[model samples]
Target: MLSKSQIKVITRLKQKKYRVQDGLFVAEGLKVIKELLDSNLELHQLYTTVSFDGNLDREQRITEAELKKISFLTTPNKALALFKIPASKTIDSDQFVVALDSVRDPGNLGTIIRLCDWFGVKELICTTGTVDCYNPKVIQATMGSITRVNVSYLDLERYLKETRSPVFGAFMDGDIVYKTDLPTIGTLVLGNEANGISPEIEGLVTNRITIPRFGALQAAESLNVATATAILLSEFKRKG
Candidate 1:
């Protein structure tokens, strides 16, 4: 059973201020919760509907209806966990890194996080206006990849200008990525879902690259941001 105070904490996490103040974020679903338990991230509390043996001993096995009451998910998950927001690591430009320029959708951001983890990319750079990585939707979409990826919010344009490494931006009119030369160590910039890359950072791109389009030319504008990221990252991996 959840106390009124605990319910308030769950509600408070929905707001950014509370999340920042507490330095904790919620991770939903049994799979995500399990991954968080195994990772170096600390588990503040565990809310679950089933029993399992893992790193946490301070878990509560609430009823399914109780989980629904507290869950931010559309369909309540079997578990919800309060995890310590791990300290952000310093940006390492010595290897392939992804820079997100205001990717707004939580699902798109989360899928990118998963891709970064899958591709062994350790660091993610997000512009200040990008979607909160800890947002419930992003957490759910990451599907446990959140535990492995390090997402840092930064002044993207300034960082791009300061770093000596090559910066690549994905745009429709850019050079074809499949035929272009990709560097082993640099930043890849993916821009906003609707607005595309901002003009300030547009000039920061050392190489403008685009994924080749094929098949039906239905007036579809472009691939979704996450799909574009997968395509770009896959091409980079091919170079390795």
Candidate 2:
């Protein structure tokens, strides 16, 4: 049975401040919950309609009506689990990394995390302004890829400056990505949706690259940040 206090705690997790205070975050859907269960993240509690085969003690079977009360989604999934936010892992400067410069959209950040997972890019560095990876919307968008990626939020410009490998930034009037020689182990910095790369961060970019549009009309203004990330990552992976 879902208690009043339990409902209060779960509902409070929707806010970033509350999540930080509690040192936990919520993940919905059986798939995401199960993925987290298999991950290094510790499960604080599991609320679901059906019993998943495992430690029954940690699982709390609740009605769908009860789930709706705590769910952030309009259509609640079969399960929602609270997982402890593990300590941030140190960024590995030796490998390929993806850095975000104030990319605020939760969906975009989530998709980028998935992209990092897909391309075998283990470390993701984000500016303080970037949307929190643990945001319920971002967690939903990541599917199960969140468990495989190491994401860190910090001062992106300073991090870029400190990196020894070549730093690349995606820009509008930059050299074509396909023609440029991409390093197997380097940092690729992507900017915000509206502003693109900020000037402070721009100064730190060792290489400025862009994906050229082959469309004859060129009607589209720019690719979505996530879509652009997909293309850039594909190009980089293909070369290596």
Q: Give the winner by lDDT.
A: 2
Candidate 2 regions with alpha-carbon error over 4 angstroms: none
Candidate 2 lDDT by residue in tens digits, 63-106: 99999999999999999999999999888889999999999999
- How many pairs of residues collide in each model? 0, 0
- Give per-residue CA lDDT, model 1, range 155-187, as digits (tens): 998898889999999999999998899988999
Candidate 2 positional error at 157, Å: 1.2
Return the top candidate by TM-score: 2
What TM-score does model 1 achieve against the real structure? 0.95
Q: Candidate 1: lDDT over CA atoms?
A: 0.90
Clashes of 1: 0
